[model samples]
Target: MSDSAPTEHVLLTPGPTPLHPRAVAALLRPMLGHMDPEVFAINDEIQADLRTMYGTAPDTFTALLSGTGSLGMEAGFANLVESGDEVLVCVNGSFGARMAEMAERYGARVRVVTAPHGQAVRVEDVAAQLSGVQMVAVVHGETSTGVLNPVPEIAQLLRGTDTLLTVDAVTTAGMQPFDMQGWGVDYAYTGAQKCLSAPPGVAPVAISERALARFAARRTPTPLWYCDFEGLRDYWSRRAYHHTVPVNLHFAFHAALRAALDEGMTVRQRRVREMGAAIQTALAPLGFSPYVQREAERLPTVLALRLPEGFDDAGIRAALRRREISVTGGLGPTAGLIWRLGLMGEAARPAPYRALMTALEDLLGERGVAARFDEALAGVPV
Candidate 1:
């Protein structure tokens, strides 16, 4: 590979995070037929690991899809939502809104309960919304604004109701503690690229028997043939072909799951928490306050910080790129007002954390903005 061949840059944004070295090699492994016994063994290992990571025992049904997280989202909705079904979507970020749109596209009667972009969706509000709803959907970790929703409480609220609970754990899966069975989360999905430290293109989905039964009894066929859960489940379970699985991406996911197990979920969660604390501490004295008020409510892997009074967000982002650092600008309501910093998987290490802080300080200082570089770095605990 030529060094100047537009060298792939390190991704510091939330999803499709920086990949582990071993995961890269796994992706390069020779591909096998999806129906091969060896490949099926690999799939079995991946499913078992997913069960462990999700903290669910007998109640979980796991499947790997040949697309990104959004595909899993569609799968979950398309299977449960038929025409005239009532769906309540809790919207606090971009992903939640996407869920609502998907439900509507499936011909369900969709009701949206929205909160401010950086705020959590209140469980009480969701409970009220669930009065006549068949399903309730939320984003467990809203990557758009770095807010972690109260999924446990929300799940508890919907326990005995007819409303099924579905969560989008794309950014939270490997970096936090998620008990799907314990919390009664009927359906959930995650992408392989975020905290899994794998390349993009595969999504892992978990469905409870309750959700599966709902799919079996759907009155109308799902609008999308490709994402129909019943058909896909037949293929994935019997090793029959509904569509070609992305064989190389499965290799990458297998290696990524091994890395996650090696690190242990507790250790990985601690590392993510420590990195978030360090970044928050380092930026405080430099006049960069977090957009979210309560630190505990924020997702550890992604941080949204307010930009300096006069600094342009896009300009600062461009400056960071010039220095070989990649940070994202906010989306929707936060656009141009905040910068999103992601510390996920391999990219969540101390080296990248320190580098980002130092680079930001230098850029600000050179632009004639006053900042205490030494004090900021010193404030970061060892």
Candidate 2:
């Protein structure tokens, strides 16, 4: 017997995944005044939860910037970098390359240590680029290519250096293990819409003591008015007048954080990891292969697939969409060569995965590839 059709479209894209019911409910609530005591209380709770999620000390500075993850990235660079300062960027995917570009635009003498698409950047490569660099930036999870860079190793390599290490954990924040303090990451950023299961709008950023020190010691002010770290921090605290805080998004973000904590970080990470392993095992028999060669380097939430020869990338994705399933195509170099499937937040659960896989089986069968729906699903331990 066929599974019942889902009541809503399944979101299989790398981000903006299906929201948790609590998050949706929170989003629907009426907005509060930016200065309301209740709003302040919710924001405080969100900040505390964010610190826990980032694995940082209680005293560490954390704030929700009023933009997407890219704003977080810009805030990290703009607040820390000065003109003529040397900056090194490790680029393995679109997001990594974006860091390099943003650094350059900030007037830093940017140097990029790059790897081929669908692969993680090596610690050795990043180390080689570190000399005289005032800051080093890398993306912890490269959603575009489904590769998780060796962030802890890179952090270890940069230890004791004056050069700060910044990371973009937009896709890895809740799904994978991210210990900013333990890993010695000075600055790390994540989006609300990814593993947080909230809609896009806020970027929850954590700043280390070293990062705060660097910000304090900066010779010049951060150019951007909206995302300036100091300004955001003050606004979140007693100041309360940086910008009109997105009150509804804050509610959604708070609800998502509560849901994440309720699930427990350890369990959530394991769920994503197990689902990812199941996907790999299930697809292997159907002639699909992972874009990232090493299992260790693959991102659990965003799975990049190398289609079998003669399979049309656009055609298959379009077919999936028609069936109310959504997946994304590759970006930049990997474009037209691979497909990206996201198992994130609410969508990371068994029901969504089963819906996606069963639909995929039918699509592959239509394309003349005999995919065993039951056998493939049996591989999923959910």
Candidate 3:
């Protein structure tokens, strides 16, 4: 590996979005022992803040892990699901499919209920597939398609059932409204990088008492040692030193959580909605349309747009790269046909929207696609 590789400041990708200056500074702060009194205090404060951000009162058991959002998924399954247990996974995008794969890896009988790439999963469809299911897992925000699943409705449908309701809120956590308690979600996980504006190493997970009880009564040992929820809770709660916690990452997460609370969840939600609407409005005149049909079903943090006819997705991406912009290509089935744009955390602003639109217009012009940049930009709010 060469150390001289050029690096860019722009991060327009779906995840690991731009970090706030305060969060970056927190990462550079003096490290402390995981068992240090001050560090434990910070950890306790962050757990409380996570509960607030997740909109769950006393029902959630929250933890901060030293990995990405995928770790939370593994932890969720490893703790709640057991060998021969039936798990129903609702798949609409790449992340949804990952849930099924993770459950199967834990020896659970995985049944996937899939919707088309750009469509939202209907609650009725999920209920229909819930027969004999021990757990129901869904991605609240389909990051690959920018479709927001009706999590509350899905939760309500699963109410009073024996099945546990697990949700992946990686792309929607702080950027949108999620009521873990009100929605009756048993387990929910989110990455710090997306809406929280923290560095990528930490994943915040919230589990309901119901889910913890299931974990306590597991018939078999959890397949993964690192992700065992009972052990992790003992470590985080009792400070028993299960593993050396990532001290600096915890600092970054604490700073990010403070920022989120300071900004207020309502304020953050409004900013996301406004930014998303602005981008959609601006892109319409450029002949770009959103993959999601209903605005209500769209995630404010991530946007998926269809490529214009005859335009090369990779070529345009390369052109943007020369200009220091870094939008990403589609994933899985949507590859080459669509582009995923992230307006997460601090990037959910008018200035970044303007910059991206400007670069896109220039790239389209170079590719012989007629684009009216001024007209497209005029639609955005000042």
lDDT of 3: 0.84
- Taking the tens digit of each residue's C-alpha lDDT, what string does model 3 give over 85-163? 9999999999999999999998899998888988899888987888888899999999998889989988998888878
TM-score of each: 0.93, 0.94, 0.93
- Local distance difference test values of all predictions, in order: 0.83, 0.85, 0.84
The candidate that achieves the highest TM-score relative to the unseen native structure: 2
Q: Compared with the true structure, what per-residue lDDT tens digits does model 1 show for residues 1-382? A: 5666674564678767889887999989898988888888999888888988887766477878889999989988888888888999989999999999999998889998888888899888887777788898999999999899999998998877778999999988888989999998888899999889998899998888888888888777777888788767776677777888888889899999889988898888877777766677667756778898877678887888887688777887898888777889889888888878887788887766556767776877642122333333344442
Q: Give the alpha carbon lDDT tens digit for every residue of 175-256 in model 2.
A: 7799988889999999999998898999999999998898889888889878887788778867567789899999999999
On TM-score, who's better, 1 or 2?
A: 2
Count the clashes in each prediction: 0, 0, 0
- Runs in model 1 lying further than 4 Å from the true structure: 1-8, 366-382
Between candidates 2 and 3, which one is better according to TM-score? 2
| Winning candidate number (lDDT) | 2
**Candidate 3 collision pairs:** none
